[model samples]
Target chain A: MNAIVSAPAARLVHVPLGERAYDILIGSGLIERAGHEIAARLKGRKAAIVTDENVAPLYLDALVASLEAAGIVSASLVLPAGEKTKSFEHLMTVCDAVLEARIERNDAVIALGGGVIGDLSGFAAGIVRRGLRFVQVPTSLLSQVDSSVGGKTGINTRHGKNLVGVFHQPDLVLADTDVLNTLSDREFRAGYAEVAKYGLIDKPDFFAWLEANWRQVFAGGVERAEAIATSCQAKSDVVVADERENGPRALLNLGHTFGHALEAATAYDSRRLVHGEGVAIGMVLAHEFSARLNLASPDDAKRVEAHLKTVGLPTRMDDIPGDLPPAEVLMDAIGQDKKVKGGKLTFILTHGIAQSFVADDVPSSEVLSFLKEKHPR
Target chain B: MNAIVSAPAARLVHVPLGERAYDILIGSGLIERAGHEIAARLKGRKAAIVTDENVAPLYLDALVASLEAAGIVSASLVLPAGEKTKSFEHLMTVCDAVLEARIERNDAVIALGGGVIGDLSGFAAGIVRRGLRFVQVPTSLLSQVDSSVGGKTGINTRHGKNLVGVFHQPDLVLADTDVLNTLSDREFRAGYAEVAKYGLIDKPDFFAWLEANWRQVFAGGVERAEAIATSCQAKSDVVVADERENGPRALLNLGHTFGHALEAATAYDSRRLVHGEGVAIGMVLAHEFSARLNLASPDDAKRVEAHLKTVGLPTRMDDIPGDLPPAEVLMDAIGQDKKVKGGKLTFILTHGIAQSFVADDVPSSEVLSFLKEKHPR
Candidate 1:
């Protein structure tokens, strides 16, 4: 009998959830042995492959064959590509498709796509039959760096992105580096924001590495591999300690609080802006906000702006275009923000580089004024 | 400082998710002191309460008052009542409402209501800023007994029920039995299904206890007050051990695998059959299925039916005006179930009154045959 084995790279981080905490095996060659790895997670004789259009044409068939090799019959559910698919209607359609294919709780769901696929499919895997076994086969660099490492899954609604979802951890996360080559230049760059975020949140070294090796990531070189893998390790470490985002895990939202607001303002499912672009701008805003409050030296704040600009990411509203939303709009966007409590604004500000604090007293007025500074001139 | 402490009779069941593991605190009057207990899980001064029309009108102000007493400023978001409100639109509305309300990341969200409210609020909590702090204040027995303890949150779809969702655990679960007194008779019975499920899934002694004191549950007597708390403990213990339902946790599906199908076929929001009523009937079907498969004795099946019926539950499909729905329809409903994988069936059937086996068999033909027997006029 082929028993499940943990990946060497995954061991760099440990899941903090005792029995629920398990290892995440990430590598270019990881997919080859994935069947053996996931066999133990199944209690039934079949499997379901949930993927999106982008990744399906590339690896769907191969994944199905892998499951078949493991004696688990497989069926596939291919969703339309892009963020638009992460909706209530789309989620139900996927459920219809799952039922149409006869997926069951005893069987496992192999999420064979990028972040959007992983989010929607992970969510599908999370709630189907209350919960089904799922293995993440992330085909995007961003997903590999952040999404695949954590078990957070959900769909987007008109109100906001990922507003309806769960923290359903996967049985296994198979982040194959090989798929990175398939991404377009724009897509590759988009995923890098998270790579950058790991540094902004906790891994200062990884951030420094990205600053030094930005070209390698863009050129797809040797250093790029280590950068993505290192980012994954950083994320995995945090997630292992705080899988539910109730404590230290909230630190991961370094760019997201503001980033999500901007994304929601523009319509999350639209290509008007990728999540990374928003975060790129959010990082700059965060530092500026940090400096405005005397939490960080203004020099460090400038460095943040310059570094994000060096990678060709948006640092202002004009970068994406349209209009500078009013504070009420921004407030409306941030108000429904996950950080708010009883109308209190919680801002994750930095006292300095490698220093962060969660505060509800940044004041909406400050948030609005700072965001206004980013107004296109 | 008056810390929110568990009831004297409250039993704690710790979920085993490494650092994410939290105890399910069960007892009467737990909600009155939830502010202190849940506030202990945080380091901030803000709290948001997401509730519904019916529940909020009755307890929202009281909850807010309690939070203020604890020096925690609280905000409340009240939506329309009923399961139909558990929609994609509502999830977005809530997220935006909260974000616009300026809730802080340091502030936590208190999910207060029955199952729908718990699910939608929990789901909203999941994606806001990538997950806000969550405290479940279950107001109904169903919410208290099942939805509160486990972090399962989501919305229903046009195709079926709970098709879109996630597993977002609460930092603390506040199941105050006093809330149950406000439930209508039907609502009370609906809540009982989840509580009774604990006994059916495991712990025969608990099942016997139910048989002895079920009168008190309907009578709403203190004699069975511990029953509410103990039932939650049983569930919380199992969920803690298997937070993601990989193994031992599946036993909790004692009647859900089939019950969800009935809910789907009948349209769950219709109020024609409350979830527990369907579950109560489902327990009967599951027992019969087990006996037919010779996994259980005929006597065991009879006792299971008798208990549910004595509690004013329907033991057959005739309770609702639905047809036998062809084998294909039954197949379709089961397929739409959150547990389907690769077109196969996974039924958690009882081998006896207190033993449930996650069965990978019970072929499509057998299931169709069973449906024919159970649904035939």
Candidate 2:
């Protein structure tokens, strides 16, 4: 037997019929608790922890130490950080590194950076042979709250963000909220938008609590940590029910439709207006569009706007900062969105502050009017 | 609303549960027939088609012509080929190309290539402004029988092949049998592995039928076409039931674990083999492993091996074109396969033909022994 000894205690939630059913570990310190868990699942082997240059500098050593402590050997695959790093070329780099390191399936993969690392590494994990097993150690706020929880993974193509990839869920997702302390406020806030989306879509109680506890989340406190972790429960369950965003689970796209357009329109080059900030504006626009379409009341739009503004997210045109691209440019780019059915536009419009719908067949004229009104050139 | 009213209606099989219901259209001439079907689904104002060079060269003009014939204002994005091309850089190319084409939210994206193009384009559609609609016109056998039918999309990274991507099912999948003519005999043969898998995993009767009819299927005939389309139905039904590889549906990985190992051992280089060829060999190995373990009867192993060989697929070390990779090299690569969970291999070993189990905690030594026997040094 290997030197490692731990409970084969991790639970695999059977999504049924079988390979898609993933496990969820409500454990503590797994990022550094490698061997214990690895031994239980992997039968005591080393792991190659794939992180970014940005993340490895901070935690790769600790993860390596954990694997060693478990009597397992370990390696590090640290790539340069940036959204651009989450590309097929970078995925190839990781695959090559894994090959160079001779990482075996007997070993595990610890994706130790943020979403990009998790995605790049996890993606490498997926196709390393048609797949591999990896854990998610989300360093970025966006990852911990969103990307880390879903088995959804992939890199970007020149055509778009995350154009190529798969639904390769992690064996374990280690979201050390403590890591958020190291994140820039903007990145941390970007993650919060997804956390808040949960409340806005299904859990009004969480929304109420979020409104009350807005300070803690923005401030990045223990309470926010609990919220983010527990928030995973809701998302995980939703994912279990609709892992492909096929049903009600699509409510998660609350502000994504309009927000992504705005982001794409802007070329998403300006860091000043990150995804969360765009969502903040997009949610407002969605509410405004809903009101305009008589699908929602102005009060609902105002409520969503207030919630975002209160969280210090931008709710208007001036909120878009940095060298911005034109609205027409973003619109043109957004035309490539996957959500478009045939040649028609689809929108996730809200009926109220917390109720959303993935409205198919929405006319472009109406959508353009929404865009023109919200961010007039 | 541009020209001819070609209502290429998609034949949708609802996996149920509201929104997750996707369409699977299996008919004669679907890939070439995409424009009208896609345009009809174009609940939007404009549409874009994402493809690769190999496909675009053969099909783009016709697709564009078909769309124009339907009076739809369409645009196209042609990417390069191989796993290498599904990168963020290429994704950007599509993004730029789409933007240049003046697409709108009311438009849709047609993934008019094989799996690579479908993945990149589909993912682009998925994330574009928080999601857009996309139609899949799968050209490769792998895509037609497998990938194109599922909403799963994404790109690769330095880490792996399809490590990054999303599970966004297509509004419709157009599987045109005519496209099979374009693939080299090797590629066509490679895709047949998956065709073989469906039968091997769940339908022994289908397996028997394959033994009877594969000649016609490969040589081109109504029965072959029926079987191919039926294979899509088999997978589509399974996907509708599971959507993700979470349940009994995971039975699909019958040979994938070992196949992925072999492929990874080769770094997915085409020089060694195509993805399907690796899978073909892996299935034989799995059957032999089952027989060796006394889990499956020798006759079952013989039957499985015989079928693969009958198709001219490599079933033994001698059959593997080129030198067999070193045993240790192969085994070590196997160790990195994502299928290995915890230190044990979770193989889809069968008790007999069509009776498989997701056996976890299987000793790696046994795995190495199986390979030693199947792909001896």
Candidate 3:
């Protein structure tokens, strides 16, 4: 992996949602400038920073110094790290601490970790005082490319992941690629799945570009920043067009249905499958399923699987550790997906690479049989 | 209270929020039509009905029958009735039950009771699937005129009331005046405070109309339907103008700031002071505070107090059942109000009745002194 140390100029991708539109700033060293960027845009000088234990030691001081340098006073709550932190108990704790800190409406809530922190903090911000000005300083590649851009903030309930949340747009998103350097190799590989997702969604030229530049992206070069910018722009366009996901926005969930069911089948054990890893495998499954349905060429499925495998991401059910549940169990979990409309399965299927569309009224029997063939348990 | 029980034609009040807009159906026996009304708007055939213990016996069967008649399959979750049920525990129960029922995004979560059920159920709906189709069959006058119309759904926290929730609008609201006949006189009087709140906010003509026709409104006459419809219209307009409470919508909290402080002081003991009754006293305090600030005439406060007294609503701190805390404590509670902006007190101080506005940067010292004068502890 190449290490290019000098910080590049930041690129701004604006998500226009009328009054709720905000900008996502992408580059290395953006976190050190977050205080200035946020203070310039928001009127209030006080803020509450919500982060996790893993992120606080490495990044919290720089964040605090930046805020202090900008004359912005802040209080913070450090939660336990990982997906389990996205719970009602932690949400309540954050809400109480925010209110206890006297963080008022005009003041901001800065989510300074990965997806869990962003979702939980954004949710607390969304509900406290009806809503608060929110700033996202996402520390992981997955959050920078996906969760941080969209206003979909929430926590996981036992029923499902991200089943509870609100569409709360951030006032600003600072996606500092420098933070990604601290992430483990496995974790970085996981986030690359979502970065690859945008290319597969509708950008064929971008997909071709990613296939060539995947190594530079992994190596934290200018290509890394370029990929993040491209992903945010794609997401911003979708979010602005359908902020509420009433129509076209559903296309963004290209691999989420199968991804979520796979996670559920594992009982959301991160040891077996992290979200983006699940998406890696799910995307491969979706492409393969499309091929099986004769909607796409088998070559496209092979291409998707090959790229995901090259990135060191899991791209098949067999890639997950341990004996898997029978296909019927996985099928049942898919039925519980939020995308299912009136008991009909809705899948984001591809005609070929970068040619995805929402396929509603998908035959359940076909899915069950496909899963049965794939699992063969 | 008179018991004139033949059903009247429904009155429809449209809350125009562009595409997010919905209609509030007010009159007698609208609950009996809830199934068809909701079925018409949403394509999904399954529903999860959320109600409280008190409402289940009184109206749940009728609601189920109505849905059955419309060929809508249903499941139900009955919660303990009252303000206490609006907690995290019940919210989790409701979320779990809805997911267990497999209520899809296109399907609905019907809130079939009063403000407590509406707030909790609507919150469950808001978070479940990120959001679900919602229908409000409000069984109490307070809910019909206030909570059901605004889409301000949430649960109470130890820090304060409505400290957590989402602005999830219902696809349909059925406000059946016939249900009001079953309420105890005190309960009905409490709801009357919210009805009076609409008039007090910015409708002097409606206030004058209410002052004259309040007796008929209490009697379940045609005036009752008229009163509910007018109040719904008043709230609908405000909600449309500011869906997120960022501006003029704060006027709706005319009595709520002081009222919430009082409720907190009493440990939210409904026996001592229910929400609407607390709002009654709080509204009087607001008017009096406006007079003290020379923002309005003292006679405006007096007139407001007298009208509330005539309707058997509590209008002063002394009307509360228990011995009270010192002014400093009450002042501290007010400091914690969600309306407090940047450690400054914000009040819905009025020019007089029907002339309310959001007053930001109100001095905390001034509030303390006024509370000291009013409480005289």
Candidate 4:
């Protein structure tokens, strides 16, 4: 499982969204093949590539050359890196640039970075001419496994994260696993948190597989591609079941509620706590809180925490370097999450691994007390 | 047909786009009954009303009072009036206001003005939280007959008008005819252009009826209601056939190719010429151009011009109140239209009245020569 190779056969995950359906191709060296793959599928020969400054320096040229080689004309916009780029100002800039390129309805806008670029560019694609064909060339593990497959494109407002956007699915997704090799150790671990989330949601067998083979995944082997494929497949099923998050899709928010609150508590400073780390802690908290409610055994929570810790992920809130606001302050952030309905506390609590369910109207007092107990003294 | 009355029974136009289908209710006193009508359909009790200053002074209070009477709590934002308001700046302000109002996914955002407000507010409603229930309470004649029905919501950018937007269908539309009484004569005449448009698009009988009943439609009687209903049904059928404007929908732009160029020439200044007036002139041009191409008889072009002129609409370029650009420049603006694909000219030419058809690959030189012939020397 840990054997390293030059390349592997590409794997495909089809998002079954009827007319909006698309394919996600995962393997090493897929980025070099992006232009040919896209040209084969789409009718238009024009594309606008949106990437961050960091990614532009690394992958933008190769992607452009590939496109030009395939007789596809391309223009590129390189934005500053990070989460703050998911904003209305940047959305305006991206939109203007795409329009400036004269990319029409059938032409494509390609997202070529991590979540920030994917979300913002997808949003711009969604609105420019009421929607241009979109393609995702996710350059980070987090995006490849998550944002790229889901068409939830948006920008954050002063009001909240992802508070403005549209559901504009991509025409195709190219997840080049080799790019994950360029991510820092911390970023890689953070992405693994979401990969683990899939198993925790409904696949105990996959969770056990990760526990045994996560190291091979980190080592950039066949297991890594398998893990990413499985995560995308899991998400695709949920999206097909409920594209708009009307029902069972809430399960995808398993640790997102607490994760987002923690992100807010830190002012979204990635140095203090990146999204995946917050989610790592939040997932453990969810399992532990469920145990306190007697819905799951304490041993299950411990097992989950132990596996995450072994992967070098921060599984406790105190793992965050900076001082956090009081538990009640974090609670306020939770109340502000878009997922909270009519001020009711909605959470995904687990009965055990692979047994998560949406727990709505959970009393605020109980959540506060649990957070208080879990807070650093 | 011109008999005056206190109120009239509401007329309904159902846009059947499957699950996104909605109803447009047209009548004399629908505004006074807005709250009851909305409450009957939507589940959410919270609404955010977006109206412009001109409308706020007149109908905002009545709309608010009606909503309140029906047990709906609401918040209102009054933007400045005019076409400039349909922009990214206003879009951000509206999105922020909707978020600040805490209007959730299930809540509603109601647009209570003309095309600018409806387009901008509908865009905000479409994007805030991926989508919110939308209601359009169009307060102008142009909106009631045309803009309010298609579910096309967007904002203008430096690139062009409606260059950015989404296809967010409204849950309901209330086009109260009594509001037309408040429009200035010019504004009313401008809106009548679109009513004439529906007839020119596909209904020869409707065009003939409007020609015979022009005085009564202007007098605000049964003919007015009948004309509005017929226009909406025409638009509804077109929208149902091509909700995204991919195919048969292009016929709806019969006059728009010339109309949009005229608007762009005036920099969208209402003091010079408004949208419907531009369409009136454009519709005439389309017919004449068709005659030049021998696709339609010259008599048809004369009839369209005669009917529009009788309704007090501008039916020619020189009717505009200012110095015009050269026909070449107007043709340049037409080239920049989003509908123009790959530099090929596309125009809605007619075989005759009620015989509009999309003509693609039209020769640009032919268009330029035709424009020169029509321009005032």
Q: Judging by TM-score, tell me the better candidate of 1 and 2.
A: 1
Candidate 3 lDDT score at position B293: 94
lDDT of 4 by residue, A124-224 (tens): 99999899999999988999998898799998877777889999999999999999988999999999999999999999999999999999999998899
Please compute DockQ, using alpha carbons, for every candidate against the native two-chain complex. 0.29, 0.14, 0.73, 0.75
Tens digit of lDDT per residue, candidate 2, span A205-260? 88888889878777765676667766777678778777766666666677877677
lDDT for each residue of candidate 2 in B258-353, tens digit (9 for 90 to 100): 777667667677867777887887888788888899898889888888888888776654554567677777776666554555556678889888
Report the lDDT of model 3 for residue A333: 84
Off by over 4 Å in 4: A1-8, B1-8
Docking class of 1: acceptable
Q: Best candidate, DockQ-wise?
A: 4
- Worst-scoring 10-residue span by lDDT in model 1 chain B: B2-11
Better of 3 and 4 by DockQ: 4
> Positional deviation of B262 in candidate 1, in angstroms?
4.6
When summed lDDT is taken over every stretch of 10 residues in candidate 4 chain A, the lowest stretch is A1-10
lDDT of 1 by residue, A1-377 (tens): 44444544432244456756656665665666667667755576677788887778888777766666777788888888888888767766666666555566666778888888888877777666566777788888888888877888877756567766667787777777777888887788778888887777765776787789899877765677777767877777778777777667777888778888888888764457888888888877888888887888988778777888887777776787666566568667877655655566777778766576667666888887776666623
lDDT of 3 by residue, B73-106 (tens): 9999999988999998898899899988989888
Error of 4 at B71 (Å): 0.9
Give the poorly placed runs of model 2, Cα more than 4 Å off: A1-377, B1-18, B31-33, B39-47, B50-60, B77-134, B139-143, B150-168, B178-199, B202-204, B207-219, B237-242, B253-289, B295-315, B346-362, B367-377
Q: Quick one: ranking by TM-score, best first?
A: 4, 3, 1, 2
- C-alpha TM-score for every candidate: 0.74, 0.65, 0.96, 0.97
What's the lDDT of the predicted structure labeled candidate 4? 0.91
- The digit string of per-residue lDDT tens for model 1 on B9-103 reads 66566666676677777666666777677667786677778888889888887788778767888778888888788987887677777665555
